[model samples]
Target: MIRVVVADDQALIRTGFITILDSQDDLEVVGEAGDGKSAVEVAQRLRPDVIVMDVRMPVMDGIEATRRLAGAGVPDPLKVLVVTTFNLDEYVYEALRAGAAGFLLKDASPQQLIAGVRTVARGESLLAPEVTRRLIGRYAARLRPADPAVTAESALTPRELEVLRLIAAGQSNAEIAATLVIGAETVKTYVSRILTKLNLRDRVQAVVYAYRTGLVSPND
Candidate 1:
């Protein structure tokens, strides 16, 4: 089963997510927290597979909580899914930078929510390429990348670079296979190599790395 922890200041919202997630045979609500601080605490204790976090909460916001749970220095980071009633680009950008596996609008359908959790649990990112690009276009200027000089050319083979570009473009493994005239497993291998070379945790981080390093730009 995929263990999930729900964190929201609103009782109704928290309960609603718990109900929706728990009804799935493959999913279970391991814990719930009413604020960001509590969310962090519960996550540390439960070590859930996915965390459904609210962006704005008292004591700490979801962004900071995500950083604490899944940030750069974390040894065993948990996957986080930032959920909000608002679609503020800044929130989405910060959440991703803070190591969230994806962003979900609270009004997203119940099925979407379930899918988001499953996506994150399976170690896949939930953010679409277009959404990631748009959010980065709006907020990337506010944050400095850890390394501005890093380039895929220096580290990856030409074919691997192409695969990274397709991933940054938001193409799925199947789509990338079709585009590159390769097998799906070959595309997966390229993706794995790209991640290893980049020292990225997952495709979501790879997407962020691509944008931050100008491998794929906002205009592209």
Candidate 2:
């Protein structure tokens, strides 16, 4: 079973998420928290497979909580799925940078929510293609130009470089396969190799890395 902790400041929202998650045979709501701090505490203690976090909560925000639990340099990072009513670009971008494995709008369908949790639990990121492009593109534009020598080209082969660029462009494995005229399995292998070579946690980080390294740009 995929253990989950639903964290939200509102009781109704928390119960609603718990109900939907518990309905799934493969998922279980092992814990729930009404605030960000409590969410962090319960998550650390329970070490659930996924935590459904709310962005805006008292005591501490979900972004900070995610950073604490799953951010960079942590000895052991937990998977976080951030759910927010606000679909604002800043919130989504910050959540991803804070180490959330997935970001879902609270208005997303129940099926989408369930799938988001499962995806994150399986160690994959759940970013919508359009959202990934818009949010990452918007934020990446503010970054300073990447160092001339620091790039994926040095570490990745030509094929891997192509795959990385497509990934940064928010293309799924199937999309990439079609675009590159390759098999889906081949695309998956390339993605896996890219992550391994780049030492990235998932596709989300790969997108960030690609942008940060100037492997791809917002215009691309």
Worst 10 residues of 1 by lDDT: 141-150
Once fitted onto the true fold, the runs of candidate 1 whose alpha carbons sit more than 4 angstroms away are: 148-150
Tens digits of per-residue lDDT for model 2, 102-203: 788888899999999999999999887866777787788777765634458888899999998988888888889999999999998999988888778898
Q: What is the C-alpha RMSD of each candidate to the true structure, in Å?
A: 2.0, 1.8
Per-candidate TM-scores read 0.90, 0.93
Q: Compute the lDDT for candidate 1.
A: 0.86
Which lDDT value does model 1 have at 136?
Answer: 61
lDDT of 1 at 15: 98
lDDT of each: 0.86, 0.87
Number of clashes recorded per candidate: 0, 0
lDDT accuracy of residue 96 in candidate 1: 83
Winning candidate number (lDDT): 2
Across residues 1-220, which tens digit of lDDT does each residue of candidate 1 receive? Answer: 9999999999998999999999999999999999999999999999999999999999999999999999999998999999965456678777888999888887889999999999999988887655655676657555565564556889999999888888877787888999989899999899899888888888878877877776776567
Error of 2 at 59 (Å): 1.3
- For model 2, the stretches where C-alpha displacement exceeds 4 angstroms are 85-87, 145-150
Residue 207, model 2: lDDT of: 84
